[model samples]
Target: MRLATFEHLGLRRSGIVDLGGDGDDGAVLSPFPEGTDLLEVIRTGHVPATGAALPLAEVRLLPPVEPPSVRDFVTFEEHVEGVRRSVDGTAGVPDAWYDAPTFYFANPCAMVGAHDDVPVPPGCHALDFELEVAAVVGREGRDLSPERARDHIFGYTIFNDWSARDLQSREMQVGLGPCKGKDGATTLGPWLVTADELEPYRDADGLLRLALTAEVNGVEIGRDLLSNMSWTFEELVAYASRGARVRPGDVLGSGTCGNGGCLAELWGRRGDQDPPALRPGDTVTLTVEGIGTVSNTIVPGTTPVPIPSARKRPRARP
Candidate 1:
């Protein structure tokens, strides 16, 4: 089932996409609560039905989760090769990097929904896009073997790991990481397709042959096949949860895939060189074969409200 958590007419609910019959008949069918995203719904096992089954068109699609916990891994070899080739002459996996899987936490708060305008932060001259697949964890587990990892997955969704190339390059050289460089913008979903629906495509390699593509303002920019991933999802899950428990709703993102996954990989584009790095009017769309497309717009950044300073509290009463 293509499940979604959405708000329509001020009412929030979770439901399976009833893409049956006419294309215009799409509806969100369950009534849960505001925070009822796909991961939460699946963990319960009881799919709740909604009122009036709000037609999908009128409702605004929010990020699959208002606040999503994201854990990203660089599992595709081709992507690594492409990036290495771009950054330097270095190519192929360094033995130590392959000895065990490694991961990084992308921003949880940067999550934006389909059609939402992703902000291109001020002074960031070079911005790029990454096309990826994400696995949503359904049940919490620790030391889960490869055989059991798939069972813990709830579903799959698309992820766009937007980057500030210049910031990332400078930060990585210091060996600290692309902390502020990466925390800028990351996006997910028009909807989250459940594991049951994606099961047929899942293989021993856990690689699905999906045609993935990216376009800027309707112009084709990048394309690749999901089958090109070097490491399988099961391997990543096992490696990630070796000792720590991966809880339900914790997202694992398949880092950027090969070819045009990012500007740095596609072209030698980096900061200052590109005059217009994703302005307010630009739009980006990423599409995976089985799942639908997710499109987002670029917008000017707004200063987030500052948290008021806390007042010194009076002495507490005995």
Candidate 2:
């Protein structure tokens, strides 16, 4: 089932995506409460079959899972190599990178839904987007074995790990990791498709069956088969929990994968490229094979304008 968190009639809710409907006709029933988002649903370990009514197309889609408890390793090799090539002139994944699956924390408060206008923070001129696949944990357990990893997975979603490359490059040089660069804006979903529903897309050859793509302002920038990933989702999960607990709603991002995955891969150097970093008018669209598209527009920030004092106002005409 493809589940989602959405806003309808000014109230937040949750439900399964009804692909059969033109607008409101096909949404399957799910009983969700007011302001119930994906984070709440996943935490409960279940999704009911009824909810308040709304046209699926009319409602705005939020990240499939909000404020996930844990986010695990980024295991895509092409992504690592790409970053290394751009930053360190190295073309191979480091031995340390392979020693264990690496993980990073993404800001839950900054998570945004499809079609939402993302705020481009001031002084950040090198905003970039990363196309990735993220999985949510369904059950909780510690030191999970590879054979048991699949049992812990609940669903998958399209993720855009929006980045400030300039900041990222600066921080990584100090070996402190990606703190400010990665947490800016993490995008997920049109919906979260359950693992059981993706049976047809799961292959036995250690490759994901989905075809992924990314476009900026209607221009295609990234495209690749999920099969290109050097590491499998199962491997990522097993490695991540080697000696730790992996809980429900723990999101495992696939990291950026292959050519055109990020600005660094698309353009060799920062200023060497012609097009400016993502601007206010830009629209980013990320689409997965079975699942639909997740899109967001960049907009001006909401800094309050200064109000003139009453003393500066002219006296009202009597």
Candidate 3:
């Protein structure tokens, strides 16, 4: 079943989406009460589709859930190799990356809906979009083994980790995770597909073989398979739960796919001549097979506030 949080007649509500025969002319069946928190419903694990059904086209889709926390992992070897140069001026994947799934905490409050407008961060020029998938945690668990991680996942959704490459590169120089460059915005919507719904797409090795694609302003820019990840979602989740906890409403992203997932990777591989950076008015769309598409239009950002640098202080006697 596909669950969604949408707005209709100026009221935000949670419902179940029915994608008809062609997967376009669908309807939303309201199960929970109006103004109900979708994250709470996911945590309670009870969804009853017994209310009125409204045309999907008539309502505006919102981010399925307001996640408590978001951890984005880089498990795509090809993607790591492609963007290393642009990120840290390196040409190869670091050895430490192979030892475990590396991830960074993203600001959950910065999430936007599928069709929302994303503003390029102030002082940013090289805005990029990352085509990826995200797993939504449903059950609480700590120090879980890889084999038991799947049971804790509630569903999956398309994730677009919008980035400011120029800003990211500068921050990475200090050997720390990205901050303002990434906190600007992250897209997560269309709808959430239950974990069981994707069982058919799982390969023999238990890895999802979903196809992912990204486009900029109606032009195709990136394409890759989810099965190409160096570490499976279970492994990523398991690694994440190591000495920590993963609770309901927490999101875990699969990072960016390889072979044109972002313009930074393209620039690193094909030179900075083609695949231009994102600008205001340009729309970025990411689609994942068996899930759905989430697109956002770029908009101008507010001017950054000025901050004074620290001044040197005289040494004090011990």
Best candidate according to lDDT: 3
What are the RMSD figures for all models against the true structure?
Answer: 6.2, 9.2, 1.4
Arranged by lDDT, best first: 3, 2, 1
Show the lowest summed lDDT stretch of 10 residues, model 3. 22-31
Q: Cα lDDT of model 3 overall?
A: 0.88
Q: How many backbone clashes does candidate 2 have?
A: 6
How close to the true structure is residue 44 of candidate 3, measured as C-alpha lDDT? 87
lDDT for each residue of candidate 1 in 1-318, tens digit (9 for 90 to 100): 777766777866666667656754644444455655565576675666555565777777766754346888876776776665555436566676676656898888888877778887645656777899888877778898877997887778888888877667666877766776688878878778877786677656668777889888888877898778766676677777887877777778888877777666655433223223566788889999777788988877655455686689998999
Give the better candidate number (2 or 3) by lDDT. Answer: 3
TM-score of 3: 0.96
Off by over 4 Å in 2: 21-37, 43-45, 51-53, 70-72, 88-91, 269-271, 301-318
Alpha-carbon lDDT of model 1: 0.73
Q: Could you give me the TM-score of model 1 versus the true structure?
A: 0.85
Displacement of the residue 155 alpha carbon in candidate 3, Å: 0.6
Q: Comparing candidate 1 with candidate 3, which one achieves the higher lDDT?
A: 3
Better model by TM-score: candidate 1 vs candidate 3:
3
Global lDDT of each model?
A: 0.73, 0.74, 0.88
Off-target runs (Cα >4 Å) in candidate 3 are 27-31, 315-318
